[model samples]
Target: MFLSEPKTLTTSRGTFSYREGGSGAPVVMIHGWPESSYCWEHLGRHLKQGLRVIAPDLRGLGDSERTEGQEHYRKQELAKDVISMLDELGIEKFQLVGHDWGGIVAQEVALAIPDQIRKMVIMNIALINNLKGNMEVIEKVRSGSGKAYWYQHFQQAPGLAEAMIPGAEETWLRFFLQGWSNDIPEDSIAEYVRMYRIPGTPGAGANYYRAFADDAKRWGTLSDHVWKIPSLYIYGNKDRVIIPEYLNHIEDCFEEIRVEEVDAGHFLQEEKPEEVAGHMNGFFETD
Candidate 1:
């Protein structure tokens, strides 16, 4: 994504495509839904000089091969694909960065191998399981999310969101990209539109939302688990769906957390790349 060609690796799950750039401590960057590794293009440029940016197109999203089954979209299952890919790539341990769905998957990866990640940075999304039994947070998020997360319900299970994507691909894609952010990257958006034009890609994207139930249940088993890893969370204060209130009780889940709230929308990195990268570089200690 950062002026590097996309590389392919075959795993049991499917053929995954990723971009690798720079050389130093490895930093795996995971992108969120409706956008591929290309979304990291801007942010990766700044850190690539001092860090190895490994940005993978989540299965069925970018240049990666789409695997069958709705279960594949579940964040835990997606995390497995990432771990296996890293193992095969011969990366022992590394830092992590994730946005949107990637943020959720990054949590799964951290939880699965707390010892492997030197530091973790997550943006835009909140890990709900961390909230556990806090009724106030639980109630607030449920009501607030109901209005914001209406698309989740539409995309989950025999949802109609994917059906709408086939003919009006750009319309559906931009619905989130343009609406969720104050500034939209035209190049990245054009690339995303081209990718979604592929047959079956829309369904693959929708399946991610379809696995909400499975993701919740999987994280439920770790309802009491709290990560002690020094972590940084980048919050987009103006996010329409994942409102700022999600920031409440976040400290309860992490032993040490540094939250940087940006005056942007859900796609904070895209809206404010230079500033976002600055926050990340400072937290990650990269000059």
Candidate 2:
């Protein structure tokens, strides 16, 4: 149950920051938008004994270098960051786990380096291509009833997300604590806010959405690539941002896939860590 403070490593793209902890087989955890590596703190500590967990703040979030260019926010760009982080640590192979935007990054990483990953665990996310094709999410967005959550697009608007959400870090910290999980520990919330409050955090965080929009628009209608790696799909049945139907055709894109549902929301790991970890151990133990 230990975490290395954020450290910087130079990559082909730019200087990236990440945290490492635990021991044994490498397991890199990438967090979604508006979150730092802190999102995996609980699960990382629990899995530390047999798994070396490395959590990195994506390009614009946490302490990672956030430079100009929406290109830096592309999903593939984040995947490159993961590869570069592994290379910096001299790790040739590992497992991957990601949530939200991090889940999107995990998908691309598994595709970009299929041979390097042993297994991939995606939480509360469908494939980017599948998500694009999901009519439910589109209908929700079109209905305008999603304005409260889909306000992500508004957050991407220049200077608005940061401005509207006063004490942006604390605002989001409290938001997720209350919105995503039912039993968020007090100390964890403190740590979560610490990273979220860092400088340049807002724009870098919001860049995730900007890249998501571009990727969805550009790659729309393109069939997704199938990867041979063993994969696990865990989604919260109550997740509002992503409908469960998005995961329906996901098996068509992966050679080996298993799906599990939990009685939680978008932040399943936080809400049900023990259940999530139990399933993860059971699935990863499979031959």
Candidate 3:
């Protein structure tokens, strides 16, 4: 098991790191923020039937090379990293799966190269268009249930994020790693903490949050075109960051969309790998 560290690939953009395993139809898995390709390890185990899974750490996060500015971490640019690495690998067509921010980037990839995506699957993430409405809901939650959007508020001051996060990286990660999923492995938490402990990773992770407005505007440029490919949305019923209210109009963005809710929290794949992989496998394998 190449679990200790992932393999690296140098593309035209820069050198990026990824973990690839198994063989057969290509399946690229994109991990979310504060998570490297490591988050997909649990689900990758079940996808060994006939799938070659390649999980990439989005640019600036995980072990990927990072540029100084937060602006370089926008979703469109993140999507470009994935596209470049795949192109370098000579992968012309493949299935796509993303969780958290990766889900949003997957949307960008689907939009950019729709002809190359055989199918798509996303978990616990809102599309760029839905982010504006999501913020509104977050405010209502803040006033009602007091569910704070600390990350958003904190990342609003990127400088502070870089300064403060490093000292308390483990604590911050613990809140999400232990709190978000009921069944995430202890080793997974340790692995993420170890990764974040590397210099600049904390700031790079924050860059993703810092680029929210830029992502929304960048994604806005590719509007009004509906995706015709088959896509599946796997939602975690217990996710605190995103609620059912946010997905009310997701159908408008795609031609064929199916939503499957799992009995878990934000890290649904980590919490329910079998169920998550089952849905993805069934969806991708079917006619």
Candidate 4:
């Protein structure tokens, strides 16, 4: 199967829920929005054979407790939750992996505690600043074109997303799951819908995007900072949400980085778990 049963930790942030299995150097897996730690089930099953795997549902996303206010969902604050969870678990150093918004949080974690992370893998996320020189891509995403990321803009607007997304969560969640992946299993989609249906769950997802301005400001303030950790950048060639073109500026942001392209779409771990886990194992195992 995947791993041991879920465990809960009361951290400085709130009650954090995670799944852990195997033994050895820890590999913390952070899942992105609209999905829970369940997203890592397949990848975790493989990685757990050789490495201790820790996958946590980001605050307010899955079984984790929801903290009130948009500020609680800021990327930096989310990073703190990861750090707090590690503290509670008594883990000192570990490898990190994240997808989508989770990738953004991973970047923040690395920035916050560079020494705590050994190697890192960021999947299907644009970690670089969009305002730097990617105006064309930014405009396309904002205008809802072929590579439209309209949801980012949509979620930033207060009350609108919360009002529209609650009751019709499944329909909205399925649109992204189907549109972003080559063919996600219906059961996976149903599981995500079930989680989002929890009272106040949809709002927590929206809060991640709602904190975009604060995240952007915090990112800009740290623009001169560069990530020193060895990093692997994995992206799917067919990922419409975060197009491969977004990889253009990654080198400028990180000191040591390598790029890999897969044939799947945005939800690469779901569509190509073996490939994703293979890359992670290779990078994390090497010096």
Candidate 5:
């Protein structure tokens, strides 16, 4: 039986899918790339005991309707989707939590509409401010067997999408799920794969990275925004995709920043859900 109700929302652009539960101050949870709102199933169950949780699958992922065009993959454009979702739901202000690419969207959302966000908890990603000078990490991951992590570079090339369509979902899912969790039930993988198979999703996922350069140029020097609200940053000590060191400068960016390193990997929420949830709840309880 499901712990929450999965709802489909009609936004200005398309139909977005989300799972919501609990009943308190609103807390919006955004899932990261190659994953869906289901990523927060476990964490949201814990959070729901005290707070209302809305976990949404961004466009092209999970039950959300898939769309064509590279413009949909841009962070700025993606952030607008969240804004529209909030407006559609009649939520004026709420707390935010996001992981991976979803974290990037959360940052942009905070920057674009600070009035709508009361506080934020980010897991497994550095602030857009930290994206500055991260090309070295990009090149490093792209250099060796890690080339798969940089698949977006290839997807950006003409005809690569057609080349990747076959078995792309399974291959990518297996690549990221390694050691993410020993307890991930069989159904979880099935749920992820179901969404992964959605038409045009593979291209949309890769396009997120393909458009990174453009996003960097458009939101240059994040120091101006510097996250003024209360914030918490949680990272997996073993996260291979996004190095933990890049977050070194985050303290200087947010005035009331709290940072914690957990003993897990890139999929921290899955690898160490209890720890991450505990830290998140404690932080949210604070003023």
Candidate 6:
């Protein structure tokens, strides 16, 4: 039986809804913005054949409780939610995988408890410091030279996003789902729309962007921090949201890292689950 059923855990911060399946070593999978643990269903099914898989809806997203303040959505606090969830489950160690915004949270979780994470895989995101200060990256985003992350700027506009997004949530979300991938299943898109339409979800999603500056500051302060565990970064060559060029900055952040480029877009796992799962399996099996 694939353990994709929803399960909830009450942590000190709030209740977190997650899915658990398989029966071997644990693998915690985290989803990014505009998505939930449901995004990992395909990948989880693939991994659950040989490893335990846990996919959680981050606080205020999916089925998780909507946190009280925007501060609760900060990357550090989000990372804490994952840590606390594991502690409550009595899981002391596990492998980690995160995509997009989840990739950022995974970095914080690994950094917070390096000893507990056996290995990590970050997909479709550039984990680097001084994001705001990186003029080159800023120029790429601002100039629309390669990939323009216009949503990052728009979401940071406080009350504006909440005002404009709710009524047209499906339209707004389809823009990302279609724009970022070569192909995504219609059912997956519908699922995301249904979940985001839940009350308080739009504001909760926007809070992630609202806390960008603080996230940048935290990464900036940890600029010299080097990742001790083995890490793998998978990038989609056609990812319009996060271009392949961003990988240029990731080399210094990890002590030992390997990069692989796939022929997909931002949502590579969905676009190419077998390939993504193959890479993950090979990477995780290594010493």
TM-score of each: 0.93, 0.89, 0.92, 0.92, 0.90, 0.93
Q: Over the stretch 1-287, how does candidate 1's per-residue lDDT look in tens digits?
A: 46477789987767898888878888899999889888888877776357888888888898888766898888988898899889879887799999999999998888788899989999988674565443455587666546666777777748375567688888888889999997778998998998898888988888898888787777667657777889999988888777655676787788888999899998888889988988988877443
lDDT of 5 at 140: 62
Give the poorly placed runs of model 6, Cα more than 4 Å off.
1-3, 129-135, 142-147
As a whole number from 0 to 100, the lDDT of residue 269 in candidate 4 is 91
Worst ten-residue run, lDDT, model 2? 128-137
lDDT of 2 by residue, 41-62 (tens): 7765555257777898888777
lDDT of each: 0.82, 0.76, 0.82, 0.82, 0.76, 0.82
How close to the true structure is residue 39 of candidate 2, measured as C-alpha lDDT?
70
Which RMSD values do the candidates have, in order?
2.1, 2.4, 2.3, 2.2, 2.6, 2.3
Ten contiguous residues with the weakest lDDT in model 6: 128-137
Candidate 6 residue lDDT tens string, 175-237: 998888967777678878988888888888989988888877777777667788899998889
Off-target runs (Cα >4 Å) in candidate 2 are 131-133, 140-144, 166-168, 221-224, 285-287
Deviation in Å, model 4, residue 208 alpha carbon: 0.7
Model 3, C-alpha of 57: deviation from truth (Å) = 1.3
What residue pairs are clashing in model 5?
none
Tell how far residue 40 is off in model 2, in angstroms: 1.6
Lowest lDDT block of 10, candidate 1: 128-137
- Candidate 5, residue 66: how far the Cα is off, in Å: 1.2
Candidate 4's residue-wise lDDT over 121-182, tens digit each?
99988774434534456665666655365787788787777788888988999889988887
Clashing pairs in 1: none
**Once model 6 is optimally superposed onto the true structure by TM-score, how far is the C-alpha of residue 279 displaced, in angstroms?**
0.4
